[model samples]
Structures are given as structure tokens and as C-alpha cells.
Target chain A: LAKTTQPISMDSYEGQEVNITCSHNNIATNDYITWYQQFPSQGPRFIIQGYKTKVTNEVASLFIPADRKSSTLSLPRVSLSDTAVYYCLVGGLSSGSARQLTFGSGTQLTVLP
Target chain B: SAVISQKPSRDICQRGTSLTIQCQVDSQVTMMFWYRQQPGQSLTLIATANQGSEATYESGFVIDKFPISRPNLTFSTLTVSNMSPEDSSIYLCSVYGTGLNTEAFFGQGTRLTVV
Candidate 1:
């Protein structure tokens, strides 16, 4: 399993674009980057997943450089409701069974007005 | 995504007692896993429950302390044995159901407060 490192916390104003970067320098070729958002008292929700280059979803966009050493999750026009902890996970979608994920201490994002 | 429900969403238990948390999925799943989350902390994998076989526990967790059962594909249970203050945490169960691009779904969680 690959280890991930993220900032302890970050603050941003509402309506501004916020980007949270995660570093997984030792990522393997088969490893994929996934981001999850979690709110208080609730389970974490799947945000977006990517392998290389860029991947966009309805909620956010993931930017990965060619080196794949790090990835960034970009949230456009943040709101107070967007305040939550963001986790970066590196793993591959298994071919036959469930791929276990290890959730490390994630970056706590606070969206301020 | 599958809809999951757990029993006793929150409970307060006495020391040395045991509490069993139940997990139910709307559809049959291939894999089920249990996780423990301390307050303001990241999640820790407890074990993986498979039907008709014993659960595989992670390091620092034992089957005797956190016994698990998977009677079938749609349901599973986790028991917190000999509860103490250290066992006070949120226990969540997740399932990976059948599909091409499936993701794991988690129950609301069981908040166990042992005193």
C-alpha cells in the first residue's frame, strides 16, 4: 500500500476556487489516485478517481502531472457547505475482488464566508 | 450503490459488557468490511468478513476482541467484546456489491460509548 501525506488544514473563502494537493511520491504504476469527501457524523462519499493526466466529474476535477508523484483536487466556487475533510487514497480497482483502502489522516478544509 | 442499515445507531454500554452491531445491505454483496474510527481520527480497518469463512483481522485487532460473522452475502455482524473506555468509538460496516464499476457503501455507523 502507498502512503499519503496532506496538509493538516486549510481555509478558503466562499465562491473562491480551492485546490488541495496530496503527495504520494512512491506511487506505483498500477496505483490509482482517489479522493473522498467526508462531513461530520456521516460516512465519507466518493468524489473522483484518476490514474494519470486529468479526470473531471460533476463535483470536482483531479489534476495529475506526468510524473504522477502528486495530485490535486480542485473544487470550484466553494461554499460553506463544502467544509469537510478531504482524503487522498492510492489503490487500484481490483479485477476480481474488493480492493481494500487505507484511510490516513486527511486534510481538513474549512470554507469560510 | 447499495443501501445499508445498521442496528443501534448509537448506544451507551457498561464496562465489561458486549455489543453486537448488525449490518444489512439491500443487495447481495461479494465483500464486507468493518472499520473503527476514533473521534477526530482516521479510519482503521478492523477486519474483512467473508461468507462461510472466518474473518481476517488486521494488526492490533483480534478476532476475540472484535469478532465478526458473515452468515450470508447480504448481512454481517461485528461484536465488540469486553467493552471498556477504549472501545468507545464509531464502528462502520461497508459492502462491495456486484456490478461493473461498484463502490463500497457504508452504514450510518454505530456510536458505542462504553463507560
Candidate 2:
């Protein structure tokens, strides 16, 4: 398991791009960086994942440098509904079983009007 | 992606009572996890439930306080016993993907309010 660090909170206006960065200086070779979004009364939803470089999805994009020490999640054209807490986690599967996931205090993004 | 249905979406329970949260996955999975989220805080791993075996609990969480049952691949339950005001939080269920770099899917969490 790798520990992750993120900003405590961020404020963004609607229609703006929001980038949340996570630092995992001790990330292992097998570790993958994953981001999840959680709304007020709902479960966390997987937003994006990346092993290296960039990966884009319908909801967000992930950027990872060659060192894999850190990664960023970019949400384009944000809306008020996108205001939520985002979590970044680094881990790898062990022996084809799902390993325990440790979550740190996430970055709380507040999308303003 | 997995579709998880968790029962008792929200409940207000009395102090000293217990509440059971049920998780049902649409498909079979190798691992099922339970997590607790305090208000305005992040999530904490409570336990990992594997079918046909004892659940592995995390540190600071005891089996006596939070017992888990995984009778099959698609179903599991977590019981919070001897509840108190401090026990009020959101409990979530999650399942891991089979691929090496796959993401995990989560269920709509259960909001337990011990009054």
C-alpha cells in the first residue's frame, strides 16, 4: 500500500477546468493511481485511473509522469453538481484477490456558480 | 463494473442497539469490502469479507464490534453492534475488479444515525 497526499480543498467556478493533484512519492512499480468522487449522500464513484502518461474518460482525465511519484485528475467544464470530495489511492492486487484499500483525507472540491 | 445494492439506505437507530447492513452484488466477486465514513471526513476500511472464510478486520476495528459475514460470492453483511452516537456514519460496500489495474465499484452507502 502506498500513502497519498492531496490538497484539503479547492474552489472552482462553473465552466472552468479543475485539476486535483495527488502525491505518492513512494509509489511502487505495480501500483496504479485511481481517483474516486463522492457526493453528499452517495457512494464514491470511480472517476479515472492511470498507470502512466495520460488516460481520458467520459468524466475526467488522469495525468501521470514518468516517475509515477504524482498524478493529476482534470475535470473539464465543471458544474455545481461536480462539487464533491475526490480521493486518490495507490495500490496493486495481490494474488488475484482484492486487497484492502486505504483512503486518506480527500480533496474537497467546491464548484461555484 | 459491478452493480451493488445495499439495503437500509438510511436508518435512525437507538443507542445500545444494533443494525445490520446488507450488500448484494449483481455478479460474483473475489472480494467484498466494508468501509466507514465519518461526517466531513474520509473513509476508513473496516473489514474485508471473503466467502467461506473469516473476515479480515482492520486495526482499531474489532470483530466483536463490527462482525462481518460472507456466505457466498455475491452476498455479504456487516453488523454494527452496541451502537452509540459515535457510531453514526455512512457505511459503504465495494468490490474490486479482476484486472490488475482495474478500478473498484461502490454501492450507495447506508447512513446509520444512532440517536
Task: Give the candidate number with the greatest TM-score.
Answer: 2
TM values, all candidates: 0.96, 0.97
Candidate 1 runs further than 4 Å off: B97-102
Residues A1-108 of candidate 1 have per-residue lDDT tens digits of 889999989999999999999999988878889898888877778788888999998899999999999999999999999999999988766665786778879999
lDDT of 2 at B111: 97
Alpha-carbon DockQ of candidate 1: 0.53
Candidate 2 overall Cα lDDT vs. reference? 0.92
The segments of candidate 2 whose C-alpha lies over 4 angstroms from its true place after superposition are: A93-95
CAPRI category for model 1: medium
Instruction: Please report how far candidate 2 places residue B36 from its true position, in Å.
Output: 0.4
User: What class would a CAPRI assessor give candidate 2's docking?
Assistant: medium
Residue B86, model 1: lDDT of: 94
Write down the DockQ of candidate 2: 0.69
Quote the B-chain TM-score, candidate 2: 0.97
